[model samples]
Each structure stands twice: as C-alpha cells, then as structure tokens.
Target chain A: MPGTADEGFYELRLYVAGQTPKSVAAFANLKRICEEHLEGRYQIEIIDLLERPQLAKGDEIIAIPTLVRRLPEPIKKIIGDLSNTEKVLVGLQLKPHH
Target chain B: MQEKDDIQQEITSSMRNYSDIDPAPLEKAPTGIDGFDDITRGGLPRGRPTLVCGSAGCGKTLFGMEFLARGAAEFDEPGVFVAFEETPDELIRNAASVGFDLAALSAQGKLAIEHIYLERSEIEETGEYDLEALFIRLGYAVDQVGAKRIVLDTLEALFAALPNEFILRAELRRLFRWLKQRGLTAVITGERGAGTLTRHGLEEYVSDCVILLDVRMAEQVATRRLRIVKYRGSSHGSNEYPFLIDRGFTVLPITSVGLEHEASDERISTGIAQLDAMLEGKGLYRGSSVLLSGTAGSGKSSIAAHFAQASCARGERCLYFAFEESQQQILRNMRSIGVDLAACLEGGLLAFHNARPTQLGLEMHLALMYKTIRTFRPRMVIVDPISNFMSLGTQIEVRAMFTRLVDYLKTEGITAVFTSLTSGSAIDNLERTETEISSIIDAWLLLRDIETDGERNRAMYILKSRGMAHSNQIREFVLSERGIDLIEVYTGPEGVLTGSARLAREAQTREAQLDRTAQLELTRVRLEHKRHAIEAQVAALHAELAAEAAAFDTALKAEQGRDARFSEDRDRMATQRKKGPFAARQGKGE
Candidate 1:
C-alpha cells in the first residue's frame, strides 16, 4: 500500500532472513492490521536479509521477521511473527493506551 | 598445524589407503601470546568455539579482542569481532588503549568489527523468532574479511535482549555449528554467572575449549589471572597463569616453565674480587640464582650495586629492581661505597625500577618484571632487598613469586642476584629463607653482624654453593670509600678475632717483641762494660807494679851509692830509699 495525500502516512519496513513461515505470517498480519486501521495512509517495505544481507547491519536487526516503523517522529521496532495483533499495535505506537 | 598439513599431503597421496596414515592429532591455532602457546602446547582447537568466561572487568573482552588482534596482525589470519556489549567505535577506542590499532587493521581488510545492539526496552517480541539477523550479520562480517578467527564478545547480552531462552539456546547451538561448518576458530566471551562458568552457561555449549579469567584484589592490590579450565583435545598448563593486559595479553605461565634451561658452567663476577674469591674463585654461575642475605645497613645494596656496575662494565645489561629505596637514594648510597650507578645508567646498560612492593600485587610485580626483562633483555638482574616484598603478601606467596622469577630468569639464562634483609641471628634468617627459597637459589651468601669487644662488624660467609668450591672462612667485610674490603678473620690463641680484637692482639704481640729486644740489648752493653772495667784495672795494676819496680831499682841504686858513701858518710841517701825493701818485696810477691 502507498501513502495517500489527505491523511497521516505510515511507512514501515519488515526485515526478514528468508521466506520462512514467520516472515509470511508477519507480512500478512501487518497488512491486515494496516487495512483495518489506516489502509490508505500506510506503506510497507519488505527487506529480505538473504537478498540484501548488508541491510541488516544498517537497521540493527537480530531477530528474524522484525518490523521497523520508519515514517514517524520516532522509529520503533517490533520483533517476532506478529501473531498477537494487539501487542504489535502497542509496540508500533498505534494503540498508545495499551 | 604442520602435522595437519603433512596429514593432508599424506591423504592426497595415499588415495584411500586405510593403513597408510596414523590417527591425526587435533590441530590448533596458536594465540601468539607469550607463555600462552607454550602452556597450551598448541592453542585453541581449530574450527571450534572456545568459551572465555569471567566476571565483569576480569578481561574476558580484552582477551577476545587481543586474540583477534594478534591473529590479524601476527598470524596473517583475518578475524571478525562480533561485539554485543560495546559499539564498534567503543571497541576501537578500547583496543587503542592497549596499543592495538583496530581501525588500521580494519582498513587493511584483515579485521572486521560488527556491533550488535540489543535492548529489551527498544523492541517487542510477540511470537517465535530466531537470531537469524545475528547469524547473517556475523556471516557477512566474516565474508567481508575472509576471517579465519572470530570473537563473539560477551554473546550473553542476547539473554537480556530477547525474552525466550529456548530460541536463544537453539540459535546459539545453531550458531556454533554454523561457525564450525565454516571452519572458523572462534572465541566467545560470557559473563560469569552465579556459581556457573558463564551467565548463560555458554561453557556447556562450547565444550571443546574453555578458559576462565579471574581478577583478585588482595590488600588493595589487584592481579589478573588466567586459567584453562579445560581444553578438550589438548594438554595445557593447569596452574593459574598470572597475566597482564598491558599493551597486550601477556600470560606468564612461569611455574610451567620447568627446569628445562641449560646450566652454564661459566661464572660471572659478583663485582667484589675478594667476595668472588670467597665464592668458588669467581662469582655466581652465569645463569644461576644467588641469594645475598644480610641484616639492615649490612651493605646488601652496595654489593648489588657493585654487581650492576660490573655487569655494565662487561657490556651486559643489568636490570635493578629496588623495593625499599628510591633510585636517587640508591645511586647516592652506592656512590658512597665507590659504586657509581649513575655512570651505568648513563651507559644505558643498567635500568632501575624502584617501587614499593605494596604498590602492586605479587603477581603484578612478577608480570612487570617479566615484561621489563623481555623488553630490556638484561643478562643480569638484581632484586635489592627482596624481603621487603614479604609485607606485600604472605610468606608463601612471596616465595612463589621468587620461585617463578628464578625459573624465568634461569630459563632465559639471566643471572639473578637477590638481596634479602634479615633480622635476629643470621642463622635463623638463613634457616627460614633457606627452606623457603634455597630450592630456587643456586648460591647463598649470608652477611652477618659480628658483635665483638663492644662493636658490631660485618662478616660474610658462604652458606652454600651448589656446584663450586667456596671458602668457608668468615671474612669481616668493611665498606670503605674504596669499596668492600674482605679482611681475613684471625683464629689465633685468642680465638676468632675480627676488626678491633684482631688489631688489639696484633698491637700486644708487637709491644712484647719490643720489650724482649730492649732487655737483650741492655744485658750485652752491661757485659761489655764489665769486661772493659776489668781490662782497665789490670792495666792499672800493671802500671803500679812497674812504677814500684822502677822506684825499687832507683832506691836500691841510691842505697848502694849511699852504702858506698856511708862507708864514707853513713848512708844518708839510704834514708831517702826507705821504701826500697817494701817496693822490692811487693814487686817480687806480685
């Protein structure tokens, strides 16, 4: 999804080693959450460390399937498969109260 | 490594012949640290992970860093440093403190440093994950430098960053396997856990080789020690090797040096000629250890200074370690004894390290000495008043330090002169230190204060000399401006005499000889005088008899004439010759 003109935009980067189950599930879970919350204003970039292994050092990546929120005042990171959507939202500052 | 290469060649030539080659020994990668490779026999098991665990600030990271640095610099092997605790810049700065130029090594493409930043506060873990990013980073770092050695410094930080131990453990196992698969020698450092070798029990995972570093602070003196808890495939030094992280990792496995050094029969001077005569007609053996035991103010320093100056005169470097006095004080005092150490210092053959023994732990002192010896390459070393080190540690520890020191010096073929201050009787001091340190000492010279006739004089004798004939006579040594003068003690009828007692006996003997000579001369003069007096009396008697005979002759002639006249004038002249008959009788009777 690309950012829209009329609203606040959300740019996210998902870093993964390869197409593991966790990577696929994290991409799917992240897309689903953005669609329900800010479908038109959110954009996601997928970086496979297997293809661009050098990119891992720049983003300080350790755990596979790590989602880094890029477009925002403060860059935030949420690791794992994003199986618990509520915790993922809390980690990305999407739901501040939680 | 050579064996591995030979085996590789053998395998290629044998072409699957089963009985052609023997079972190959485990190959090792040498760490290039002094005494380290010697103790390990080889080094860390090649292509395996070696766990180096220790408490905080005990030099685990430094050990790992130096391993990589030395590999990259000396072994021509590229290394990767995976830093989990500090950033690459921080690592560079830390390495710089020890004189390692990490940035230069990195720029030369011989080393790579990867900083892995993990904070539990900055990220959230919602589901299962592995440390694939770490693996990828390490792999990339390794590939970037074609590394043969890698250091995962404090890899236990992942336990704090990630919440799941199961995944971390599984990933760590995979990582070690991955490292082995790549055929890279690795050193993984971990923090010491509560009663465990490592915080995350890393030793359990990396079982091939495990090293433990320890830092102990005793009496405000800290010493860093290293020990190989277990090397799975290699025999290593089992003792705790005292190491110094100055400039680099210097592991002095002094105890394990063994008695492998060759004994040279060549003797070197003790600088005092008479003392040399007292000690085997020369001085100490070239590489043997000599113990000079004495009481305070007993010229130990003077003798040691003489040795240092003598060494310099022979164009050999001599390192002097002064524990009780400053360099200036030693130089000044030695000058008073006609030993000018300043000239030796100016000649650049004599180096002095004057410090209080309490300034550092016993092991640190040994390390410093070892370092100085290695750098200075002194052929002779003098430790002035080694007993001052007794206040630094226990007697046993001090003895241990000296034992190692003696072994190290002997192995290097350096002659060592150690001066120890003793109190009470010289015998007591010798007995105590002889048992404690004589095993290390090749010669012992006991300097004692002989109290006789209300004065204390310094006397020296050889207590023991292992391989040479030494004089057993106690020499009363005096320290004058002309230097040490060894005077032979007198053992006359007045018993053993030294200093003023011998002088007094000599004076008394000389006075008795003078009295006897005067009496003999007086008796000869009296006898001569008596003989002369008797000769004079006989002459007088002879004169008297002659005079009397002449008078008698004259009187008789007058009497004859008077009788002739008396025939005419009645012998008037015969009255004048009244003494004639008395004279004639006297003459005839005589």
Candidate 2:
C-alpha cells in the first residue's frame, strides 16, 4: 500500500432529511465504524436536506439517510441507517467484501 | 405554440360545452393536447394522480413530459418533472425532438426537471428508512416553480433500487395522497407487466385515471395506440385511438364528430368556367367535401389543379397532398394544361405535401398532415388521388382515416377537395362509386375515359351533390393549352360521343341536313316547270282558240269584206247581209 501523507485522511458527508431516527442511527453507526477503523484521521460533515432540500440533488441523494465518502481517491455512497458494521465497513472500503 | 393557439381554443370551448351539459361536473385540468382533450371530454381529473402505463418504447415518457410541458406552457400552470428513467439532460433533449422547449420552460420558472437516480450497488439497506428525501426534493422542485402539474416518469425504478416491493407500494400510495393533498395533478408512468396493467400494479395507487399506451406490430408495421383504461368520476372515450409523436402527441380519434357543423352557403368556382356553368351556374359550396374520382390519366389531377388554381386566385391558401406524384411532376403536368400552379407556389398561397402512403403508417401520415395543416393554416386542402391510400390499409382502416380527415377538415371549415382514382379499365365499368368514401363526401364528380373511333377522350359528370342543385349531364372533359373546358357532348342514338367522333358526327348531321335542303330545292324546281308548262299549254290553247276565232272572224270578215269589198262580191250575198243590219239588230236584241 502506497501510504502518502493524506492517505489516512478521511472526508465524509452524511446527508439526512431532517432529524429522523434512522438518520440518527445511521450517524451513530457510521461514527462508531470510523472511530474503530481510524479514529484520529476522519472528518464528518452533517447535512439536513429538509432545510435545504435542493442540496439532495447535488449529491444524488434519495434515501432518508446517506453517507457519501468525499475523501481519498474514489467516491462511494452507502444509504439507509447503517446498522450492520460489517456491511458499513465493506461499503466504506475499510474492509474487503465477503 | 402560436400554431396551436386557435385550435386549443376550439377544443377547450367545446370542452366547456360538454361540462355545461350537467349542472356541476368534475373540474378537469385541460391537457391542451390537440384531440386528447376532445376524447377526455375535457382532460384528466384535476388535482389528482393519473397512472400511465405502457410497454417499452411506447411513448409513455413522452406523454407524461408533454402533459407537464403543455400544462406549464399553455395552461399557465407550472410543472415539475421527476424523472426516474432518464436524466434531466436526456429529458430536455428528448423533449426537443417533440418541439417542446423544456429548458426554456425551466428558465422561465414555469417548469422544474429533477432527475432521481438511485444505484442499487451504492444504496445499502442498513436499517429502516423512508423516501422522505425524495419528498423533500419533489417539494423543493414544486415550490421552485409553484407547479400545479407533476410527472414521475417510471417510478418502477424504485423496485430495483429497494428490495422491498411492499414498502415501495406503500410509499407510492402515500406519495399519491400527498400529491393530491397538495392539489397537484400528477402523472406517474410505469412499465407494462405480464397480465398486469403495470409492473407493480401502480393502478392500485393512482385511482383517479389510468391510461394505457400500446405499440403493436400489424403486418410488419409498428402502430402506436392509446386507450383510456379508466377515469373515475368521469366518462372518457373508450376507443383505442392511434396516436403519432411527430412534432407532438396527436391522438387521432376515429369517429367522435357530430353532424352539427354549420353548412356554409357561400360558393366558389371550380376554375373551369364551363364546368362551373354545368354545376348550376355556381360552384362547390364553401367547406364542402368535394370528390373528383376518375381513372388514371382521366384529367382528375388536371381538374384538381384547376380547382387549386381557382382557390389561389381568390387569395386563399391551398395545401395539395400528392400521394402518387412528386411536387415537380404535378407542377410540370399542371403547367402543360395551362393551370398556373407555379405562380401560386411562388406566391406563398400554395403548399405541396408529396409522400408515398406506404412510406409510413396511415396514422403517421395523418399526424404529419395535422401538424402541417396546423402550421400552414391553409383555407383549402387538395388530396390529389386519395385513392392511393386504399393500398395502404384495409378498407375499414382507410375509411376510418378518411372519415377522421373529412371530419377534421370540415371542423376547421377548410374546403377539402379529394381526387380519387377508379380501378376498373373503363370508368363506366365500375360496379359502383367508391364504396369507401361515397357516403361522406358532399359532392362527387366522376370522370370517365371514353375510347371510340380509334381515339380516347375524357368526360365528367356529377354523381351526387347534397344541399344544392348540380348538373347531371355528362360533358366531355377536355384539357387544352387554355385549361379545362366542358364541351357539350353529342348524346344521340350513337351513344355519348366525344373527341373527333363527336365532331365527325356533328359534321355528318350537317351534311345530311344539306342533302335534305338540296332535295327540297330540286322538287320545287320540278313543280315550277310543271306549272309553267301547264300555263303555256293553256295560253297556247287560248291562242289556238283566238286564232280559230280570229280565222272564223276573218272568214266572216272576209265573207263580210267579200261582202263589203266582196260585199262588193259579198254585196250580192251582203245585199242580203245589208238586210243583215236589221237582222244584226234583231240578233243583237236576241
């Protein structure tokens, strides 16, 4: 693995339409996964699409809760409340797929 | 847009008339589509969701997009297009093909197009979720334009995105209700399923109205049809109408027209003055469907050209549909007959539509015609050799198309002149006039080809003309460098004669008349000779008698002179004749 200076840096955006329970769960689950995977190198930004609904169109968001990886080299999106940490790890590329 | 303004006004006004039939009818949001409003009695139910389902490539998306575009542009109601199958750019480009300026509409704040793309690979169903963000986007788009109409083109994409059909169906139901509560007229499209109206049965959700678009192949030709599956709280035309997406969605309703069009009493010439004289000294009534049917090369097109020329001469726009010939060919042929159609073409008073009927389906041809007629705004339309369409479809389909065309032209108050070709070798041999169109046409002019005396000639006669007096006499239809002329045909014991045979027959009659006069002159000379000879004989008899009497008198004078000189000689006998003085006085007294 070619590890550069910002290789461990993580920039994540979490899109939620208002304060729904699933969005909160998704946020909590995503934060726990990132803390366990690489705690000190991650940055999380939360966006409420209800107050600014037009923002959802900018990132191709449709589900209630979505996590978009804006960091590293490739972009990835994981929708719904991230209850399963294994799947979230796989979606975020913290671990390979089964 | 300007081309459709007057026609839409006509449709909506008629729609108002239908809604007025009841004290209070359900209010409708007019789609402003050409014949679609006429079929829906007004339009889809207002402020309610309608389901539009069709198979792949069947124009369901176009229908929805058009609904939104028309509502936003024509009805003054803004719209939001929620596209699931295509992106906003794709939607705009596809709409441009139909002449709808969606991007301009969006810029004018009259439209909003949003693309909802959810990739199944990226979407992870980790926990419970609802499509609330979708609602937010929809609401944002709607509020952006304050739209009254909305279209969710192919919401079936949600099934692929989400593994739960049950949740999608529930969300769709809720979505429709939300749309209804927002008082937005919504159109949600879906793909066709086997034995189902839609893949997920969206009909169960949007219950206000349901439309089914079908594209089926009939004998290797693809035809598109639209049927109103159901309309709640309203009655809609149930027939499957053939539609075409030429410049826009034109649903050709086969037979919904009534016979309530006001008959115009104005008259126009048929361009040939002699033919006009034969037609009750007037011509075809304005806005009447006039038919000129004849065999090939029997001057049908020539006469049609004449009619077109006359219409253009009166400063009316004419649209000529030549199914059998190219425009240049018609122009050239008409020029040979001195019908100056080239001038009319240059004057912008004439337009030509030349296409083989087999090049496209009948519906496509009719749609192109509708689009052209709308744009050109002609006062008169000439379909030269309308019989060429008979080869394109079955008699019934052709009749349906013809009926629709005739009805449309009549409704537009444009005079329609149709030239048809009879198929028989001899026009007189035709068993009957065209069984397909004779019933609907108001005036029928039959052209015939007469072959006699080793020469071929043309003739024309009126078969039928309603609401006016038309000449039934068959006149020899002649085309010369001076244009068409209806010469008085010779109809004697030799049957109807034309061409040089008529001239020969007329000359023969004149020769026979001269022979009869010459015979009468000879008989009068013989009678004069007999009278003069009899008079001379009588005079001779009188002369003979005078001579005899004179001889007798001379003999008596001789006897008296012989008596006077020979009275010196006859004095002897005249001495007795001297005594005849007393005797003569006595004889005189006797």
Candidate 3:
C-alpha cells in the first residue's frame, strides 16, 4: 500500500476490562489486521477500563472487547473479540484479501 | 403524618432485617426560599429524586438552580448541576441576574455545572446503551466537588435525543433509582404536558416528590403559582402558592397556619384624635390591620398619612405604599395638611413606596411589597387607597394578596393600615371593597361625604374595631392646615354635619346658646322687680293692721277702768272693792 502522510494512516483503540481472554484476543486480532492491510501507517491503542473506568463514558462504552476507529473522519464502533478476520477487516473498511 | 411515620418504621425495620447497619428515615433539605421551607415543613425529600414540571417560562429552571445554589450556599451541601439544554456559560450568566454567582460557586469547588449537548439527528443508538456514560460523567462531576445535591434541568432533551421510548423510559427509571441509591438529593426539571404532570409522564416513576409550577395569564396579567403535587412520605401545603423569581426563587404560601397570631394589646394611634376617640379613646392594636374606606376627597390619604406620621413619631419604622399618588405628590399633599413626612423620611423612620397599580400584576405588587417589608423590617405598613389595586386584579386575587399581606404583617407584629376609595356618598353606601375586606380588618373606618343643604361635609365612623370597645358615633372631621381634626358629633335635623356644615352648625349652636343666655338674664331682671313691688305692698298692710289692733286694745282698757271706777265708787261704800278693781284696770292697760 502506497500511504500518504495523512491520507492512509489509521488510528484504532481497543477498550476492554483487564486481561480477559476476550480483550486479549481482540487486541491481537486488531494488531494483526493493521499489520497485514496497512502496516507502518496504522496506530493501535489498548485501553483497560478496569484501570480507567472513568473513561468508559467518553466513548460511550458499555460492553468490553470493543474496537473504535478514531481517525479518518466518521467514527465507527464494533463489539466482539475480533475472531473473524474478514468481519473485522470489513468493519474497519479494509480489503478482505489482506 | 401517619404515612411518614409508617415509612420511617418500615425503613428502620427493613434495615434491621438486612445487615447490622441501621437505616433511619430520610430527613429533608431546606430550599431556603422565603416561606417555602415553612410550607414544605422542612423541604425536599433528602436522598431522593424530585420531579419539577412546568411549562415554558414558568421558572422551573430557575427553581432548580435556586435549589442547588441554596443547598450549596446555605445548607453547606455542595451541588452538581447538569444542564441538558443550556450551556454552562449561558446558565452562569442567567443565574447571575438572580444574584446567584454560579461561576464563583464552581470556582470554590462547592458547585459543579456540566452541560451535555445531545442533538437528536446527529446520533445513532445501536444496542444496549444503558446511559452508563451519563452516569459516569455525573459521578465524576459529583466526586470532583463531593456534591450532596444534584440538579438535572430539563430532562426532556435526553428523551428527545434517544430513538426508542421504551429504552428511554427504562433508562430514566434506572437513572432515578441510581440517583436515589447514591443518596443525593436530586431535582429533575421537565416540561409540563397538556394534561399530565410532565410531558414524558415522569411523575409516575419519580414518585418520591412531584412539584408543579404554573404561570397563568388572566385579564392580561400573569401570575406564577407553585403546588406540591405529591410528596410520598411527608405532609405538605396542598394549596397553590404565589411564587416569584425576583432576586431568587420565593414561594409565598397565601394560607396562614391559622388565626393563632400573637396578640398585641398595645394600641397605636390612628393619627386622628377624634377618630381614635371614636375607637373607644384608643387607636388600633399594635399588630392589627386598619381599613379606611371613603369616597373621593374624603381625606382617606390624609388619615393614612396621619397614621404614618404617628407611627414615625413613636420612633417605629413606617413603610408607606402609595398606589394612587407619587411619592412627591403625597409628600406635598401631606405637608399641606401639616403631616410632614419629610422629617420621617429624612430620619429614615419612614419609607414611601410609590407604585402604579397598572405597572405590574397583583402578585408582582404583592411580591414587591413583601420583599420591601422583609428588607426594611418596618414596624408599621400603610397602603394608601388599596382600592386602586382592585383595577389590577380580580376580586379573589386582590383579596388573597391583601389577606396574605395582612397575615404576614400580623405575624411580624407590625401594624398595617389600608385605605380604600368607594363610589357614592360615603355614609349612604358601603363600597364593595369595604364589605369584602371589612371582616379581615381589625378596625374598619369609613369616611363619608355627608351632603346636606347643598354642602358636602366629611364624616368618619368606625365600622368595626375588633377586640376593643370603640365608639359607635360618627365623627365629622375637617382637614385643616394643622392636621386632620375630627370634629365632635354634629347632627342637624337632616343628618350628620361634615366639612363646612359642621363649622356652620357649631357656630349656630354657639349663637343659639349665647342668645338663650341673654334672654334668661332679661327674664331674671323682670322677675326681681316684681318681687320688690309685692314686698312693699305687704309691709304697708301689716302697719295698718297693727295700728287698728292697738286702738281697739286702748278702748277696751278705758272701758275696764271706768267699770272698775264705778265698781270702786260702789265698793267705797262696800269697803275695799275699789282696790281690786283698780289693779285689774292697770293690768288690762299694760
């Protein structure tokens, strides 16, 4: 992927409760998706609500293992462990083949 | 009250069943609004959510803000105000007008104001949003200030933002329950529905307390009233109370507890001596209300001015409310009658509040009066020509306002005098204002213009003086350059004499008395001459009778002597008869 300085960079946040299996799996899957489809142009942040429960209201988070896309205009939220790579890629608006 | 006790028992017993922790019945938080705490007994239910519903411009937001501000300032309870409609800056500015410096409170860490903007079309709700975000924000704000009071102004904005009504209802219920569980007194304001307590029917869920504020416009006058719709575990005033948002939210409950005001047997002068004399040689009770009713030019204002002046003379603060005249005009007129209010005004013992009845609604006028009384703390209050207020409100509203005013004055042990203007000749007919308010007044003085012989005279009479012996005589008084001088009872053959007629009758009586005195003096001289002539004639007759008696006695003596001489001549021959006869003749002569 030929990425411009700002056009192709992705910012994603994974919100979860501690080191739960679902939260761990969701973080790993998000990292893999970003590396395969748009490496070197993507940034990933993991947030454990157990440590910062006060931040749950900022993104309107109720359930754990939620992925939120913050950059590139319109925000989107998806709830799951991100086990299905194709579904995760589709939700993030990436090519399924990646 | 029973319900409250039962709730307390239930709470205490239930706590005993649970853990070792004791749960007592919830106490109330004072609102700090004037007369509001009295009506609410204590105030809003503590650790519970209260729903305040009102239509547009009915002062619901202000009420909620006042509750929070007062709670923070007076109760030492820090508060958090979450506005769903107005921005925090706007709210701060708005609150500043009512003398509440929200910004300062926030800076002191005693109050926290948060604005949550929710646009209905900008958002999409996907699944299972339980308002935890809102809860977290509120909790964060509360923790930041350690707030004990919370206010959510206009909750309908949140309901409008959400798409699903079921979810909104459930979420709102949970929100109220959560607030109650958090043990903070929360005031939730909402828009009033057409025929329901709130547009969202929130009253059904937030059942701890519900208050309704209504602003009604009648005859182009707007009056704001507040009523407590329901308080689950407390007994509260159920009647609608007039409330105003002047410097702050104040609810004035019109109904007094009862007729159990402290009695002040002390009497204060009515300013007119004759009028006071008509009131059983005294004035009015210190805490009583005096109603002075009269027709135009009957000197009602003069009497009121005199009363005010007298009150000032006693070194008591007097508040004079002039509805018909300006302050300058009243002062000028009163000065002309030798009632100089300027000295009192300068001495700070008297305050003249001049207001046009048409300028504000009746309740507004009442609120202003109450506010002034509260600020001035006057010992005496005078309303000149209270009948002029009749033009501003209905009879019922006017009566209610007057009743409340009188009751408040009585409660404060302040004397009050109200003047009213009637229509016809004051003596012939009682004005509608007088008849209606006479019962509530401690003393009712009617000033009438008695038209006799094409001349009008002013007459004053006490219609009623409660708890005192008052004269039943109508005293005709004249307003002169000195003061109001109540003339003595002057009744010609026609009727009571007033004004020039009283003066004329007084002169006539003086003339009649003088003329009768002169006539009696001439009659006394004639009777003295007749007595002297009769005494001379009787003395002459007594001298004539005495002369006649003396002459007859001399003649009888001579006869006895001759007979004795003859007897003696006979006795000379008879030897010694002459000596006895001569002694009898000498005794008869002596």
DockQ of each: 0.74, 0.72, 0.15
lDDT of 1 by residue, B107-126 (tens): 99999999888878888888
TM-score of each model, paired residue for residue: 0.85, 0.86, 0.77
- Counting only residues 3 or more apart in sequence or on different chains, how many pairs clash (N, Cα, C under 3 Å) in candidate 1? 4
Give the DockQ-based CAPRI class for model 1.
medium
Sorting all predicted structures by DockQ, with the top scorer first, yields 1, 2, 3
Candidate 2 TM-score, true structure as reference = 0.86
TM-score of predicted structure 3? 0.77
Q: What lDDT score is found at residue A62 in candidate 2?
A: 78
Q: Model 3: what is its DockQ?
A: 0.15
For model 1, the chain A TM-score is 0.88
Top-down TM-score ranking: 2, 1, 3
In candidate 3, residue B41 scores what lDDT?
91
For lDDT, candidate 1 versus 2, the one ahead is: 1
lDDT of 1 by residue, A7-98 (tens): 56788999988899999999999999889777787889999999999999888999998999877747778989999988887877777533
Per-residue accuracy of model 2 over B186-264 as CA lDDT, tens digit each:
8899898765677776766765678889897865668888998777678889888888887778886666376777789
Candidate order (lDDT):
1, 2, 3
TM-score of each model's chain B: 0.83, 0.85, 0.80
